[model samples]
Target: MSRIGKKPVELPKGVSASISGQTIEVKGPKGTRSFTAGDDVTITLEGTTVKVTPRGLSKRARQQWGMTRSMVSNLVVGVTEGFKKDLEIQGVGYRAAMAGNVLKLSLGYSHEVNFEVPKGVTVSSPKQTEIVVEGIDQQLVGQVAANIREWKRPEPYKGKGIRYKDEYIFRKEGKKK
Candidate 1:
């Protein structure tokens, strides 16, 4: 049995959930989100909580049981609290700014790099070296942050580039004289 799957997801005071076949929809103050489970699992709404169970005693069913439960839990959290990702720009002259729907980045490049923000997610630059990504969908928020960091990943030698707020770069030794 799956430990996480055994626990039902509780709906907060202002949050609500509904089930339609294999799909589950959750709505809260932040926004609304939906998730459809695979055929190996069954989803049910019990009072103010949601539950997921496997269809049979098979490996795939057991795998889907835990995964489906986690997905449903994410939906509830997404609709209620949403998700956020923060990135820090390092190195001299490295900075970021938000211009309407575009994120302008200056990472030692000859020309400034313009990144267009996608829909449903909000990107903000509270400081020249800080970037914040906020959205209801966790995956989207993380992907956007990753894409921005891809422009200039932190190098091991100089550790000059963009990186997550809590990330650590493994510094390497320089050439010997």
Candidate 2:
């Protein structure tokens, strides 16, 4: 038995869920989100709680049981509270700014790098050294942050570059001659 799957997802006040076959849709103050479970799992709405159960005794069904429950839970949270990712820029002259839908980054390069913000996700720079990615979808927000960090990953030697707010860098000792 799956521990997580055993627990039904509770619907908070002002949030609602609707089920259609294998798909479940959740709507809340933030936005609306939905998820479709695989054939191995069954989704049901019980009062204010949502439940997921495997359709068979197969290994694949067991594996999907927990995964499906988590996906449904994410849908509820996404519609209600949403998701956010914070990025911090390190190193001299490294900074970020939002010009409309474009993010301008200066990371010790000769030319400024322009990153076009995609739809559904909002990217902003509250401070020159900080970037905030916000959206209803957790995966999209994380992917966008990762893409921005890819431009200038933090180096172990000096720990300089873009990184998550709470991330810790394993600093390496520099050469001493």
lDDT of each: 0.94, 0.94
Q: TM-score of predicted model 2?
A: 0.98
Tens-digit per-residue lDDT, 73-124, candidate 2: 8888888888999999999999999999999999999999999999989999
* Candidate with maximal TM-score: 1
Locate the minimum summed-lDDT window of 10 residues in model 2: 73-82
Alpha-carbon shift of residue 150 in model 1 (angstroms) = 0.4
Relative to the unseen true structure, what is the Cα RMSD of model 2? 0.7
Candidate 2 whole-model C-alpha lDDT, 0 to 1? 0.94
For every candidate in turn, the CA RMSD to the true structure comes to: 0.6, 0.7
Q: Give the clash count for model 1.
A: 0
User: Model 1: per-residue lDDT, tens digit, 29-118?
Assistant: 999999889999999898998989999999999999999999888888898888999999999999999999999999998999999999
